[model samples]
Target: MTMNAALIRAILRIIGASLVSLVFVTIAVFFITAVLPGDVADALLGQAATPDAVAALRHSLNLDKPVLVRFVIWVNGLLHGDFGVSLISRRPVLAMASERLIHSLLLAGVTALFAVPVALVLGTASAIFRNTLFDRAVSLLTLCVVSVPEFLVATLAVFIFSVQLHLLPSLASISDIHSIGSFLASFSMPVTTLACVIVGQMSRMTRAVMIDALGSSWVEMAVLKGASPAHIILRHVIPNVIAPLFNVIALSLSYLLGGVVIVESVFHYPGIASLMVDSVAARDIPLVQICALIFCAAYLFLTTLADIVALLSSQRRHAA
Candidate 1:
């Protein structure tokens, strides 16, 4: 097939898959949030509210509606970008989530800043020195990092950095973006904790993919041609591995997006995951649903972008 035709086919497939995933994601978020124990009315009313008042509030919120009807209404609003109001806060769910979403994006962005370069270097080095002490050491260290839970890692960081060294705050109070220094200071630990986990996983994936590519006969030919190590890596090695690395990066983006709840909770980072957790605990279904839907959308966006980039690169290679 021609390169353009192949690229178009890939794009069509991705779009179809994304649309199906969106439908299922919306249904799953709605129904799963619906099934959580305890009523929103009860949670909001507290011990002071009369049973009659609870019933009235539920009616006002249309909790009295049938499940299908409520789901339909929510889906309709979602289609139009109307995320509804929080049950507890009485504010637009998206409005509340938007602020937290920025914070999360910042955190994730900073994490990627530390993670990707460090991971690439380590992975490349491990591949270059395969089976030697350096490679074995990287394997063991990453395995240990992977084996431990994120919360444990965060806790250890707090003790060592906050308790023992008194260097940084355990809890992140990163509210103002204008104050870049303070924001970085407050968020340093959370970012570090996330980076540790992310680097390990990304580096391992890079190493695995690069190892196979390096072992291919073409790499031997490049070496026999008297290509400099840098020339061989840049001209031959990287282009070959870029497609698979894109897949790895897409997965890493998803993890950085929504998988930081443990780290956020530990450091008190005011991010989207933090908002989701609080909303869940407070039984605020609208906020929870909005937060979750945003995460789903973001994951889809990153994956689609990665796939497009990989396919375009593949097309260029085919054209060549």
Candidate 2:
């Protein structure tokens, strides 16, 4: 198929997949929340409420309705862009989630900014020096970083940088920063910690892809033609390596979005992951469901984008 036609088809498929994922997220949230031990009414009202007040609260929140009905209502509200209400703060769920989502996205964005280029450069360098001391050292470092738990990294960062050195604040507070420098200073530790984790995974993926790409026929031919190593890598190997790296990038993006819960909580960063944890702990069903749906949508969208890019790259290579 033509590239334009292929692109259109891919876009359609992505939209369809996103819709399906949304439905699945809704069902998953419904089932997960329904099976939890506490009564939603009691969880909201607490032990001080009388039995009659509890029943009244349940009725008000529509917890008295059938499970199916509750799910439908929630889904319908979501369709209308309402993410329900937060039980703890008595605020609109979307508003609360939006605030936290922005912080999380900012942190993730900054982390990626620091991670992607560093990983690519190191990976390429290691590939160029494969089986040598440099390659071994890079590989060992990647493995060590990947093996360490994120929580430990965060804790060590807080201890050394914040407590011992007094360079950055120990607590994750964004509110006190009135200037950009201060904001970045406050954000540096968490971003650096997250970036370490990202670099570990991405560098490994890049190195593997580079190694495979270096073995391809084009690379060998370029080398045989007396092309400089730099020319061969930049002109030949990098383009070929991109298709495989796209998948790795997509996976890392999804991981950053959904898997940062532990790190966020560890550092007390007010990101979506932390918000989701707090919401769950508070039994804020609406907030939890909304966050889950957003995360699922993001994952589906990024993965689909990667698939499309990989397909297009492969097609272009074939055409060439």
Candidate 3:
């Protein structure tokens, strides 16, 4: 196939994969949510409530329907952008989730903005200075950060920044300030916590990719031709490392989306993770299903993008 045709085909494949992934996620979450051992009525009203009240609440919520019928209705609602109501709050789940989703996305963006370049610089420097003290020190620090659990990092950040130094608030609260500053202040802790993890993983991947690229045949030839180290890295090393870096970035993006639940909860940041947790606790089946499907779609899209980039890179290298 022509190069353009090949690229189009690849894009189509990725879209198809993402759709399949969304379907699977919807099915899995539906069954899991359906099987959870709690009645929405019981969750809303205490267990000591009268039997008539429980039965009436169940009927009102359509929990009296067969599981298959309920799942069908839930899926239909999801396709139409309705995420049902929260049993506890009596609010539309999608409406409630929307307010927090923006916060989480902003926090992730801030963390990535700070983390990615720092990781690339540190990783490239360490790779250049491999076996030296600087390399060793960077390696050790990356390992330490990676080994620490996210919650521990969140707690330590709270202790040092919020509790002791008082640089930022312990809990994020929406305020009357300008939107830009208010968002920055509200999400500072969650952003910082996520940045720590992002930096560690990205640094490790970057170091490995750069080290390998720098040691490749083209780099050796550039050095033998009396090219400056800076020129060699900029011209050869960076291009060679782009494919792997793309993969690393995609993986990190997926992690940021799906892996921040604990960190979000620990820091009390009102993000999608927190929403999912609350929905699960209340057995809000529709909310849980929607969140799971959205997350899965995101992950699948990222993975597919990575695959396409890797494919194009490989094709270019082969043509060269």
Top lDDT prediction, candidate number: 1
How would you encode candidate 2's per-residue C-alpha lDDT over 5-57 as one tens digit per residue? Answer: 87778768877877787787779877898777778778877889899999998
Which runs in model 3 stand beyond 4 Å of their true positions?
Answer: 176-185
For model 1, state the Cα shift of residue 316 in Å.
Answer: 2.3
> Looking at model 1, which ten-residue stretch has the lowest summed lDDT?
174-183
Question: In candidate 2, what residue range of length 10 has the lowest lDDT sum?
Answer: 253-262
Instruction: Give the clash total for candidate 3.
Output: 0
lDDT of 1 at 29: 93
| Cα lDDT listed for each candidate | 0.88, 0.84, 0.82
**Model 3 weakest 10-residue run by lDDT:** 172-181
Stretches of candidate 1 off by over 4 Å are 1-3, 176-181
Q: How many backbone clashes does candidate 1 have?
A: 0
Writing each residue's lDDT as its tens digit, candidate 3 over 225-318 gives: 9999999999988887677899998898788985578778887777888888888887776677667766777788888889888888877888
lDDT of 1 by residue, 262-302 (tens): 88888888999999999999999999999889889998888
Candidate 2 residue pairs in backbone clash: none
